[model samples]
Target: MATETFLASFGLVGLRLIERHGIDPAHFARELGIPSTALPDARTRLPSALLDSAFEKAARCIPDPAFALGAAECWHPSHLGTLGYAWLSSGSLRTALKRMARYTKTLGQRMSSRCVETPEGLQFIYDHGRGDTLTGWVMADFGLSLIVSLCRTNDGTDLAPALVTLRRPTPATIRPYEDFFGGPVRFGETHDGLLLSWQVADRPLPTSNRELATTCDAILASELATLQNDDLESRCRAHLLHELTSGEPSDTRLAESLGLSTRTLQRKLAALGLSYRGLLEKTRYELALRYLDDPKKSVTEITFLLGFSEQSAFTRAFKRWNGKAPSDYRQSPGS
Candidate 1:
């Protein structure tokens, strides 16, 4: 379930990168013979074939081979507007990273951070999950970007690590890797991890906000609730949510997609106290709120982004569910 959720979140950021590169993703999707509009919702499990094709296409479109890694760095929450601001306002770097690891699903995946005290010092291990072979280079670059971001976030460009470990073996680019990490870089290690001086870990935080931290924790809990159930209902919800933004989400299609009979799928949903339509609507609603909160996106864009027919249709449905128009709800002071 964590894998599915993580994949979906990573896909969202991947889509953002595709758009940021000035590539017509819709056209690219169509060229690949997949529905371009349905991409946002199809995050649950991308067919390996399609994912490879898209990745290849993106590589060709971007002039910089390191585009994916660069995008990951620039889009980090600590650099983004509201999320970054909230992180910088946290009690300490530890607290900031905790908040980030907790709510990072709201942004992307393939990356996570955890802290542990070691006999020598403190370790902050950054883990990135699987991707294509080319992703190895991207991951290496991303790891470097992370170090840079961490130092910049703390306003200390002089930050250096005692030891840096990478999962991949040594390559021709080893020199750049050494330069970035500013220490010996070990390859073919048991894990891709980093070690920080204990002093840095214990340093007092530059920003502290108890109220904001509380709010962030609460939001993470709420998001986790949706993934709590290990029953048929939860599976159905997960499946549908991962596929909805792509098209007219259907129980039959979902069943077929999962290699199950339609009748069996219906039986499963029934056992979970839900139906196909109910789960689909629930998924759409959750994602709608997330997209609507972004001031950078317009209502029309949200409509297409969520796979709705039109702005009016999305508005009408949003009103039916929330008892207020989307724009008004988004603009409300407390919202």
Candidate 2:
């Protein structure tokens, strides 16, 4: 239930970009209010806010907004160390994605990957339910990098995708999308998804390091198990409720406010058999019912309070959940 830290995975990528761009990584880290020495360990789980700010700065410093994505293309197996190397050694792109989805907590537990087969190709959807600008960008860059890495590991550049889709509309950083994708790139989509040919997914990777894969899996499983048993579930729920009302909630700030490690908080929620999404829905549902019963609260106020994108969506969801329209439920009498 800890607020999803979707951008945490990009800590290393951001640091690498700083170094590649002739900027002092340490200086950049210091500017972000983190220890300069932490750059090497940036791959480890981190507070979502710090990671977001770090990547945002990197995007600004680099000549191209897609610098991180491009850099990830040439990232050596050794650069990612055990985790990255293990993924590279997987049998196929599908297996690698499954590995990443399972151990994503090591990088960013807040986001999850879903793989689907389409007639066009294999689509890997990177779904991030929370976080801010930096977090969002990191997810985009990382997804691209992972694909690039998979291609390299297979020793086939032809396996690259025909298009990459992002949820964020074209912004000043849009140039990077064209440069990194080297193909059609679409913006302003409903969600973040990558489009690759099924043929590439069918190709086998050259290296399959079973020992490395096992070790990485074990490490990730341990972390996940720990997170699943912690008390951070309730705390995350409270944070979600606050965010729903405020529009902007910082996962790092929430963790600090609760005086708990972000990883620990995430682990606790997993142990509770719940997720941030689950808690958010529960919170919204309870609030909707409460407001529906209060004749003094207008539908617009209720919609705004519940952080709904529009009144219609809220109305539809309420009907689905309660088997009655909001107005009808409010008008029902029990006398």
Candidate 3:
């Protein structure tokens, strides 16, 4: 499937949110030739064009001008699949955001985003890849609001940004945007994203779980690697290099991302003379040793980078691999 488009369930969930406002979502879906999925599974992807139509209809149906902001308020992680879990388990807002930019295909596939570190703060550049600004504000608003929500959830604060920008035309007054975002918002701007402070992005999350995050990253990476029919091991390893920080992914999740069932993935791995767990361990070890070689990064940091739950856990595993702690190995000039 093409990258950046949302899953079927995301479309379905948007309908439900519309319905909550007493708008018949099915009518709009049917009117636009957007098929409504009976199931809530986030597997099928519809083009961004269809979603843009949905947003337009949703705006028409709702009398409220801030419907997009409200739609994002209704969003839950389930609407995003493993991307939600990965965001939830991120070590910090900055790390989570980098992961989001890296795996945008699995989440908001049509929304282009980047986190740029500036002297003042982090400026997140975001834009709807295929929609005109006239009706694109809904998608843009929903995306920006969701990013704000994710940041708040990670740092557990009011988490206001330094500045916010939108691609939509200027409203009658800026009060609604400011009131909603808790910051000054610029309409008719060049971009559609937030400018946040370094203090907010650098703050660590209480729910940080390196191992679990690595698993999520594995799914995230595989979702973006759908162009070729390369060897499963090579493809898997290549994806692993990008995703291992999210944590070890489940067999079913990884299999689905690879466009196969668990049995099929296992069979292919077996054909290649490999098992999923074995490959995962080997990848982790390789990453661990590589990270350990750099004395500047503490083992605590390396532990999270390798997706270990904690430093002590990484230490125990490193000892098993090299018969010495990571600190000892880092100190040793060589035997």
Report lDDT (CA) for all predictions: 0.59, 0.62, 0.73
Candidate 1 global lDDT: 0.59
User: Using lDDT as the measure, which candidate wins?
Assistant: 3
> What would the per-residue lDDT of candidate 3 be over residues 220-248, giving only the tens digit for each residue?
65665552225476477666766768875
Q: What is the lDDT of residue 64 in candidate 1?
A: 62
Instruction: Please say which candidate is ahead in TM-score: 1 or 2.
Output: 2
Cα lDDT tens digits for candidate 2, 292-334: 5455678988888888878898899788776787888665431
Candidate 3, superposed: residue stretches over 4 Å from native:
1-5, 34-39, 227-335
Q: lDDT order of candidates, best first?
A: 3, 2, 1
TM-score of candidate 1 versus the correct structure, residues matched by position: 0.50
Better of 1 and 2 by lDDT: 2
lDDT winner between 1 and 3, please give it: 3
- Model 2, position 220, has a per-residue lDDT of 50
**236-318 per-residue lDDT for model 1 (tens digits):** 65566566567557778888876789998888778868778887777677567656655677888888767787789889989
